[model samples]
Target: MNAPPLELLAARGTDLLVRVAAVACAARELPQLAEELAGLVVRCAEELTFCDVYVLDDDGRVLEASNRPPVPLGDADVGWVAAHGCARPHADGRGVAIPVRCDGATIAVVDVRSAGRCRDEDVALATALAGLFAPVLSSCRRLRAAKEREHAAERFAERAVEVQEAERSRLSREIHDGIAQRLAGLGFHLSAAERALPDDLPETAQQIALARRLCDLAAAETRAAIGGLRPPVLDDLGLSAALATLAREATAARLHVSVTVSGELEDALPDHVQTALYRIAQEAVGNCVRHASATCVDLLLEHDRDRVRLTVADDGVGFSIQDVFAPGRRPDSYGLRGMAERAELLGGRVSVTSRPGVGTTVEAVVPVPASRGRREAGGPG
Candidate 1:
């Protein structure tokens, strides 16, 4: 057959491209975008004077067919094209499978079969269209993937919170019921030993004294673990009271801890914010004890007209915050990340400032919703 008019082919290809581009632009609003894209492919295939045209997924499954029977696009027909990895025509027939790549990964394929012997120009045109179509679809795919990942992460975090709560409950029960009772029993045993033993039984008295010391140590560990799980004071009192209690606990342990609060704080703050702030302070103080080894720690809370701020600072050894979250690092380093996550969930942000010699400070700022501010201003102090 005489060479097809190049200008006619070009014009036809451009018209089809314009239509497909319009469809792709509308894909975001289209409820059935895949079917719409498939329909566009079939329409373009028939209008372009080809024996047959088909669109395939990245896996080579036929997505849509034009001017050809609905035959499956299998590895047999398109695998060679993918392996050869170019927009070249098949040696045996007038067909080619052009790869459709978007964001540097193949997402689909465009296959053209022609009785007129497909030319390099035809292959080039098809390649261009495929490239355009790929990016549009790829963007959609990426958006969908991102939403899925976010939902999955949210579910995972919820599950994690549930597990953590369960663990805390179990620890609370064990300490309150088991360890505390054992310590009381041990103290009674020590008292009985002191009373029953005669003046000659000094060696037995020393053994009883040692047992009492061991019991005290175990009781301290149990309390520490239970406090780490869930601070009873935070539940019994409001945030200010809890902070005061924490400071006193640390001071009793020979760690100089001071807590300061400014502005009026009422009992109406949301539960999550209260919990997040409490947990943040808890984590920060724990880190100060474990990592800082500092003699002095400061906990500060400021609630005002617009926002609430909490700060935990320690004068001790600090670390490189950048390396703190690196993979394969110590699990204890997750303290900062966890604190940040909690603050973010409360629509707040957390910042960590540290230097090797100076010290470390963790601060969180959370905006109180307008209603809370209004209520706080009007309510009695």
Candidate 2:
């Protein structure tokens, strides 16, 4: 039989590549990508029996084969091609082992081997294939690097939050158990001294009474400071009871507060998630009492199958969220920013809706990690 014309063979090859390009584009994992790449080599370079794709991995800096068993970097001809970025029977595109360099380092290498030697056309095709896939390999590495950085950032944020909570708890304990108690004891002593003092020395009696009043004020302030730190109720009774207590304590001069809890939230979420959601709720409620100038505030906490949602709405004079969180605009309050940061730390998000005359609503939704997913597993069967 006559060999097929070069033009027809090239056309068929081009058509096959076009179809495979779609598959390569859709592939998200390296294994699938390796299969597609292997298909390309098998279809185009039929004379070659071995095709290996080695890609740099995130953990180890060394290049590892993405398809088959590991191919040592110092194997043979492939090693030469990889180290020098040049191929034997040199073509315009270079060699099969020519390293695909990204960021001044070799990120990937494609090795095509035959039993005998690399034909001139075969070497050229292999070079062309590696050159074509170079950008893809580079892009994958970049994307993987970006994801790694993002994950590292998240871990740092989470650890920071945990450390912060521990410090907050320690500080809260000191203020409540130490300073508050001391102030209370001093107030008692002042009261007893006042009773012992003679009425004739009215000026001295007035001084003792005034001292007692100041002691009471200091005790109140100390309690407020303890409340600002991590709430003890979160550890004692969990988030639901804490929010209820928060609502009770949040009632301002004219502000009426209420809390409605839904779903089986007990032991459903990890500690970090619980802490984050509680912080968000605390900020929102504090903002309402301090700044909202509204009368009625509602706090809702819900724990669904795989997530927890919280809503805080108030019938208060609202302000523009854009104006509050805009760049270069540092308002007196960091409450809104704090809420957003807390939610985002746990792979969650917060949304705020407000109109001048209507009201302000803050809603936060947080995902439950799969590892801590006992709610669904132990739910009512």
Candidate 3:
């Protein structure tokens, strides 16, 4: 056999380098990379006439293929390379099987086929190409793993929110049916007893009056608890009315809070969406009163054609947003996390902006299904 000319070898080497770079750039995903690798092996080696690529997943099953039919998992040569993480010529001396590794673990096996027998140079080139793919594949695998974990976390968060809501509903019913009812009945009995007292029994009448006052206080407290557990306004009047009630309560707490609406919100939102937005607003307002020390707060609800936005802004002394969200910086930032989790479950997002001197604003934007009427003309019920 005659040696190829130096010029021909140099040209092939340059062409191979260019082709490898192209393959690297084009290999974004596992399947695309596998196909490119198989094609590159054949094109890079002058002795190879035809080539086939097979990419095996972690379980030794064929994940992708290029220019060839799927290879059986039980093929001795392919299985051996996958199991032992090595490279070798095919049993019939027509191709090479190379194990693709990442972080010291075999992830895939690349099988390159040729019409004629493969040469030593061909095998070496195929091995080098597979080596180049290892890191890329590793990075891709890690990315995919990270995405899967994120999805799992979101799923877990959603489930937690659902359970929390269920528990709240149950507790609210218990408080309303058991405690609130009993308190109301007690108030009625106290009134009846006071009426039955004689005009001459002044001391007894005074004691009865004090007992009635105490019964009224207890009943009021029970009603407050029931409202806190589950706001009846939310179910009866929808999100806008519920937010108006929140603003009124904030005002009573000495926080100058106002509620504003941009678009008419006549049509009711999905129950879950309305609940999430209301909770977010409620938490934001509470945070302002508790920590912001702001004299005035503004709550805005905007209903657009496709989405609704809620903004809670307070003209108070603001804190560092980063520090609040940083690890171990603020242990009391669970409210913010809860807000974000709730919005995320509805495929929405929450954003908070604040500076040291300027006011802070928390905004939540949630996409509404098109099936829901956007142009409905109604005010907060």
Best by TM-score: 2
Pairwise lDDT winner, candidates 1 and 3:
3
lDDT of each: 0.67, 0.72, 0.76
Q: After superposition, how far is residue 98 of candidate 3 from its true place, in Å?
A: 2.3
User: lDDT value for candidate 1?
Assistant: 0.67
Summed backbone clashes in each candidate are 0, 0, 0
Instruction: Give candidate 2's root-mean-square deviation (CA, Å).
Output: 7.0
Encode model 2's per-residue lDDT on 33-68: one tens digit a residue: 655675677567757766777776765335667536
Answer with 2 or 3, whichever has the higher TM-score: 2
Name the best candidate (by lDDT): 3
TM-score of each: 0.50, 0.67, 0.60
The RMSD of every model to the true structure, in order and in angstroms, is 11.7, 7.0, 9.0
Worst 10 residues of 2 by lDDT: 372-381
Candidates, ranked, TM-score: 2, 3, 1
- List, residue by residue over 60-144, the lDDT tens digit for candidate 1: 4443443444435445444444444455466765777776665554555567666656665555556655665666666655655
TM-score of 3: 0.60
Task: Indicate the TM-score of model 1.
Answer: 0.50
Q: Give the residue spans of candidate 1 off by over 4 A.
A: 1-170, 197-204, 264-267, 304-307, 367-381
